[model samples]
Target: MPDGVASVTLEYPKKISRGRYFKPAVFPSAFIKTVQVHDNVLSVAIPRGAPDAFPHRMVWRDAAGAVVHAFTDPAF
Candidate 1:
């Protein structure tokens, strides 16, 4: 993020169904801090002890709070 703003959302398994056993659970959402750099890779910093997140797109808005860019890859 150019303006130093970023976020992340994670979703865990709701339940597991195998054979004759089922475990139900819900995982809370986690947010990551946006690391900004004038030049370099743009990545979000996840909280400590966090697992890899699921595939998702990032929605970027301008300082005026208007949608500027949205994509899965910054190179886009």
Candidate 2:
């Protein structure tokens, strides 16, 4: 988060498949705070068998109310 953003939403993969392709799914608004009130850890369960399975996306707004997004990496 930029500026003074305190919380953000996390979108993860969801298991929903058809014949040969899985339907697109987005688990919205998994709240994550930048400034930890009690603990400084965030955890989320990733769904199996999606195109962007491991690289989950997080969304939030900056102080100017501009949307900001980030991708999670396993290497990090």
Candidate 3:
């Protein structure tokens, strides 16, 4: 990872049962300067000189603000 660049990979279920669908994950706007999604890969860029913590937990939420997915780096 380079300075000002943060990335995370998201994995979705391959099989969806009836009436099940995928919802987009929402990231914190204040911490991220830009976002790019390619397949299951999600990349977020933090502004240069931004005061933030590394090895942070990334949270994904549903429309009701409930946690749908949450993860932190395993190697961290």
**What is the lDDT of every predicted structure here?**
0.40, 0.44, 0.39
Taking all chains together, the TM-score of candidate 3 against the true structure is: 0.32
**Best of the two (1, 2) by TM-score:** 1
Ranked candidates (lDDT, high to low): 2, 1, 3
Maximum-TM-score candidate: 1
Model 2 spans with C-alpha error above 4 angstroms: 1-3, 16-55, 72-76
RMSD score of candidate 3 (Å):
16.5
In candidate 3, which residue pairs clash? none
Clashing residue pairs in candidate 1 (N, C-alpha, C atoms within 3 angstroms): none
The top-ranked prediction according to lDDT is 2
User: In model 2, which range of ten residues has the least summed lDDT?
Assistant: 31-40
C-alpha TM-score for every candidate: 0.34, 0.32, 0.32
Summarize candidate 3's per-residue lDDT along 1-76 as a digit string, tens digits.
Answer: 2222233433322222223364433333434222333444555544323323342456554434455556765432
lDDT of 1 by residue, 1-76 (tens): 4653333222223221222464433335534344333342455544333423432345555444455565563211
Sort order, TM-score high to low: 1, 3, 2
Give candidate 1 regions above 4 Å deviation.
1-26, 30-43, 48-55, 72-76
